[model samples]
Target: MKLRISHETTYGYDQPIRNLVQSLRLTPSIFEGQKTHDWRIEIPGGIRGPGFRDGAGDWVEGWTLRGPAEEVSVRISGHVETRDTAGVLRGHREMIHPLAYLRSTHATAPDKALREAAMSLETTGDHLELAHGLSALIAAAIAFRPGVTETHTTAAEAFALGQGVCQDHAHALITVARLRELPARYVSGYLHSTADGQAHEAAHAWAEIHVGNLGWVGFDAANRCCPDERYVRLGSGLDASDAAPIRGVAMGTGAERLAIRVQVEEMEQ
Candidate 1:
């Protein structure tokens, strides 16, 4: 399957920003089941991007921009060819060790509810089954509500509220898996299908557990299924904050307006 992705993010500010530096993980690397045919990142000032392997062995691009500016927009456009391997990504060759994924960040803590959930699934020995079971549990536990939680919501908070979007679900799953000594990573990308009318324009999130023999297998708790060809993996990290498509700081701020538009469609063979 071939996919074409076009993502544009715009920010309007009441006052101009003096300087800004952004860390972007928007680029995807080719593994056993996927291949990147063409990719490009476009910014207004025409900035250059540097590539490096992160702690989870995922490819990352840290790009920066500076100067007095009123508005900024970052666009990532790419095409990728993917093969469905039944959710298995084999022979992932980055040097980042598996244990590095367990280190927790401020945004992705498990708290009581997630710990309790992990306690229930204590059979052990099989990470894939455990991850699958966890996905079903998360999907059944929370109702998908658009305005229930924001990007900064915690896992325990989301679990208690019983409602959230895909990011909340993935955060909860990653938190719990790390508690159980399993290396889990947060995945940010586009899910090709959705009940919402804009199936082609959606931002999706999921969790991937590192199983020794199987490598990293993705389990989308929101959809309650392993990722197939419909999933386009853009970036991954310990939590959403690390893997966010755009993260930066602005100098001046009175009030700010933000808008995001993403489109992911299957291309003709």
Candidate 2:
């Protein structure tokens, strides 16, 4: 399948900022499952700086604004060809050990409820089976609803509330997977809504669990399935914040208001 994507993010401030810097992980991943084409990322009037691929094999680019700027915008557009790899991550070069993802973050940290739930699952011993079970549990536990949670909402909190978006589902799944001693990480990316007709934000997220013999496999508990051609992966990290597509800071104290628009659609062959 071929996919086209467009995304824009704008920042507004009451006061002009003296300086600003950003690191972007907005490019699509390079793996056996997906191939990118004509991808572009633009930040108007910003100076491009050092860029590199991290140990996890995700591209990171830097940008800076030197002037007193009150508004800033980022634009991303691209095309990608993807195929069904059955969720298995292959041909992706990375130096980081899988065990590194066993570390937990604030957003994915489990509480008593999460640990208990992980332990209660019938499947054990097989990492692949346990991962699928955990994903199913998360899909059943949370009803997909936007605006019910915040960016900082923890997996435990979302589990208790029983309502959240893809980010919450990914965090919750990562939490439970870690509780079961599975190496798991959060993935940030885009999703073209499927035939299921369940509307999800174009900016999406999921979890990856390291299964024996299979390496890392993606599971989107929010959609109750593994990633396929409809998905485009960007990056991975221990949590949402760490895996954020954009991360930066302003030198001056100006409260920032952010807005984002994203569209991911299937293109005809």
Number of the top TM-score candidate: 2
Q: In terms of TM-score, how similar is model 1 to the real structure?
A: 0.91
Give the clashing pairs for model 2: none
Q: What is the lDDT of residue 11 in candidate 2?
A: 93
Candidate 2, 1-269: lDDT as tens digits: 89899999999889899988999999999999999999999999998899999999999999998769899999999899999999999999999999999998889888899989988998658889989999999999999999999999999999999999999999999999998889999999988884496654569999999999999999999989999988899999999998999999888787989999998877889
Candidate 2 lDDT trough over 10 residues, lowest sum: 193-202
User: lDDT of each structure?
Assistant: 0.78, 0.92
Number of residue pairs clashing in candidate 2, backbone atoms closer than 3 angstroms, sequence gap of 3 or more or interchain? 0
Q: Quote each prediction's TM-score.
A: 0.91, 0.97
TM-score of 2: 0.97
Q: For candidate 1, lDDT tens digit of each residue in 108-223?
A: 77777778888787566777777777778788877778798998998888888999998888888888788878888888887777534347467788888887777788888887
- Please report how far candidate 1 places residue 31 from its true position, in Å: 0.8
The pairs that clash in candidate 1 are: none
